[model samples]
Structures are given as structure tokens and as C-alpha cells.
Target chain A: MKIRPLDDRVLVQPLEEIESKTSSGIIIPDTAKEKPRIGVVIAVGTDEDLREKVKEGDKILFAKYGGEEVEIDGKEYRIISRSDILAVIED
Target chain B: MKIRPLDDRVLVQPLEEIESKTSSGIIIPDTAKEKPRIGVVIAVGTDEDLREKVKEGDKILFAKYGGEEVEIDGKEYRIISRSDILAVIED
Candidate 1:
């Protein structure tokens, strides 16, 4: 089933962080790592103002713990309000 | 010194949460408590686009773990990007 965010919410798919290793080559466990703060906008809410600021496929930086997590078709996603979106990443 | 948040960042002074007690009247320790998710906006960034969306003195809901904490003039404040803000509390 397709998930659509309502109101000022947006659906995001988080980008994976590369594993970090110490100088001794010891890999840090996931539990000890900081949460990722970047993601791609998959869907946006219907709010006129919010729609003007964000769009599908935009890479955005968000608060690490801002949104609700959901799993769809084995992939993880987050639904966050427009205010939680920090900045759009442009390359 | 007054803190002026840069870019789309905002300075927030967190609201205090009321203490909760169990049926036996035992108070929970602060360490065991959840972070406050609400705050008063003390300052907003210079970004014109962001200024249109948020304003100083607006009470907002933010991600609990989102911002960077700083102590200024005996008061605690957090500096967070606009994206870390979840919603405006209008009441």
C-alpha cells in the first residue's frame, strides 16, 4: 500500500550512513552511533505553503529524531512535518 | 550577550514539564524523564524565507533531541535549524 502524508507532513526515506571504524579498525556498533539526519523526500503534504517549499525527490536534512518511522515493502521511511525539514540539499 | 541564530536556525528556550508522581507519590528523577518537546522561540534566523514561516515569541514543537544546547546568562537555550521545528503551537 502507498503511504501519503497528510497536512504539513512529508514522507522521507533516510540515507544510510557509512560505518565508522576506529584507528585500530574496530567497527562501532549501530547502537553507539548517531542517527542519520539526511533523507530524500518521497511525498509531501497538501498544505499550499508547505508544498511551495518542498517537492518530491528533494534531498533534505532533518532533525535526527523528529519523525515517526514506518516500514514499507521492506524499506524504512519517516513521516515528518514541514517544520522539521531543515534544509534542501543541492548538489 | 544576545544570541542571534544564523541562517535558518532558531533559538528556543524550552518549557518546563510538570512533575509526575506515581500512585505512591514518588517523583521520577530528571534523568529518567523525557526531554521537553516544546519551547518559546526567542530568536529567529536572518533567512527571509524562514522568517515568513516562524517568528520570535512563537511557541513551537520541536524534536526532543534536535538542537544544540547552550547556557547563556544563567538561562538554557537551544539552537536548532528550522527543519527541526515540528509545529507551531497556537492557542
Candidate 2:
């Protein structure tokens, strides 16, 4: 199904986090196991200011556990609100 | 020092939480020990829209762990941003 974010919300595709491990390759267990905070913007919200600040295909840093998770056609996505977005990642 | 919240931030004086004990006198420990989410608005931000929605002396419900704490004249207060404010409480 197709989805379009409304208002100041944005649709994002989360990137796989770099593995939590030491240089020696020992995996360190993260007790919290929080959701990854890096993603690429799939779509910017309808708000004018939001559209100006962010655009589709931009990499972004979002708050930990910032958005609601959804699964569509065996793929995962997140719908993030404006406050949850921390910064636009350049390059 | 006097504080005036700039932008969309609000200065608030938090109300003590009613306690985590049950009516039968069982005390439940909060593992996270998060901050309270309610307060009385001491001052509203300079944003015109914020000012129209909130005012001094209004009791409000804010987000959990939403603001920064500050002590002034031996009294405690919090600086809350607009996104952290959930709603105004009416008596």
C-alpha cells in the first residue's frame, strides 16, 4: 500500500545500524537495544517550512525511538514527526 | 536571576507528584525515576501562537522528562519547549 505523511511528519527508511562490537570483533550487548536513529528521508511532510528544511532522499538523524514503526509488503518503515527529527545528515 | 523564556520555551514551576504508593499503602518503585510531567506555567514563550495558547499561572500537562531543570533563589523550575507541552489543564 502507498503511504503519504501529513502535516509535519516525515516517512523514513531506517538504515541498518553499524554493529555494536569492539575492534577485536567482540559484540557488546546493548541492554537498552533501542531503535536505530539514522535513516534516509523517504518523503517530507506537507508543511511549507518542513518541506524547505528537508527533502526526499536526504539522510537524517532522528531521536532514539522517535517514530512509529510500520511494515508494508514485507518492508519496514517509520513515520516521524518534526520534533523527533534532530538534524539533516550531509553526505 | 530573572528568567524569561525565549522562542517557544516556557518557564514552569513543577508540582510535587502525589506519590507512588497505593491506597493500601504499597509503595511502587519507579525503575526509571523519570521527572514529573505536570507543572504550573510561570511564563510563556515569545512566540505569538504559544502566547495565545498558554499563559502564566495556567496548569499544564507536559511530556515525560520533557524539560531542563534549573534552581533559582533556592526554588526549582523547568524550562519546557513547545513540543514538550502536551495540554493545558482547566479547573
TM-score of each: 0.48, 0.43
| Interface DockQ per candidate | 0.02, 0.02
RMSD of each: 12.2, 11.6
Model 1 scores a TM of 0.48
Model 1, C-alpha of B13: deviation from truth (Å): 0.3
Supply candidate 2's per-residue lDDT for A69.
56
Output the lDDT of residue A89, model 2: 67
lDDT of 2 by residue, A1-91 (tens): 2344545778788775652222223222466476336777877755689999999988777876775554434455666789999878665
Considering every candidate listed, which one attains the maximal lDDT?
A: 1
Q: Write the per-residue lDDT of candidate 1 for residues A1-91, one digit (tens) a residue.
A: 3444545888898776542132223333557455437778988865789899899989787777776654444566677877688788775
Which window of ten consecutive residues has the lowest lDDT sum in model 2 chain A? Answer: A19-28
